[model samples]
Target: MNKNFIIKKNREGKKEDVPKKIFFKTNLFYKEKGFLKFFIYSPIVKEYAFYTLFPNGLNLFIYDKNTYNKYTYLRADWVKSIDKMFFHIKGNIIIMSHKGVSLKTEEIFWDRRKKKIFNKKYTKIIFHSKKMILYAINGIEASEDLKKIRLKNINGTFPVK
Candidate 1:
């Protein structure tokens, strides 16, 4: 519902709209929907192994540090295992991988927050909020269509600047 949170934080300057302070393992991320819908998904810890379902319906805590190629689908078995281990969270906030697509959007959301599977989406010029993680679904039922942040070696953009 707001854009202030999306402003890149200036390391040298004071950061606004962001949490007062984030610990080494603290989960931090922002979420937003079509236009006015907004929320922040803050994980309990810095475990990137946690799984996220789209549309804010599911939450999984995985610690395997496992990943697949871009645009790959999230199998039901994988989703089930993630659910079974929804508490083995670990790591430094593992983020979703686009699988391989290089596109910028403004419509990211963490859908189905009540389920064990997470769905997400991307858009352009949506709102902004402080969240530790986001789960969303943009009218899609498969994770393969979700263009997440991919790994560098997988022909995706590097997280480093």
Candidate 2:
């Protein structure tokens, strides 16, 4: 039996189109300049003609180049990659950095080549060190590590230190 091709009948009892590829319990690692940059794990992945889908969600760990230590982590309930560099992520998106910053949103677009993440939906950012919570009403743009961030139309309370 071919793992990629699974026979499934539709409501009319006709066979559906099988995915080009399917991966189960897979880990993908990306390296840059002989240094580990990203590690992605997904329980299931399906590849079609135009895109790859992570239906069961995925965890992405980003490592520092010099130290090779994980500096950021991202999780999403659903992800679709149209190409190698660009990804559309949605459903309970959470991003955390080792610098004590966390971001929560419903959807986001990630550009791996540019090392940028952005969204046009509501976003909540928390600074653990400052004990402050920020809300972005219009959207947010930030680096992958959440180091340099820009929030638009924001209104939130900051604890006075």
**Best-fitting candidate, scored by TM-score:** 2
TM-scores of all predicted structures: 0.20, 0.84
State each model's CA lDDT, in order.
Answer: 0.27, 0.89
Put down candidate 1 lDDT per residue, 1-161, tens digits, no spaces: 45323334577776533332333323323223422221223323211122332221123222112322222212111111133233222222223324322223232223333322232333111112221222222422323233333222122122333
Q: Which candidate is the best by lDDT?
A: 2
Worst 10 residues of 1 by lDDT: 72-81
Candidate 2 displacement at residue 106 in angstroms = 0.6
Model 2, range 34-137, lDDT digits (tens) per residue? 88888999999998766789998999888876566656899999999977689999999999998999999999999989989999999999999999999999
Sliding window of 10 residues with minimal summed lDDT for model 2: 62-71
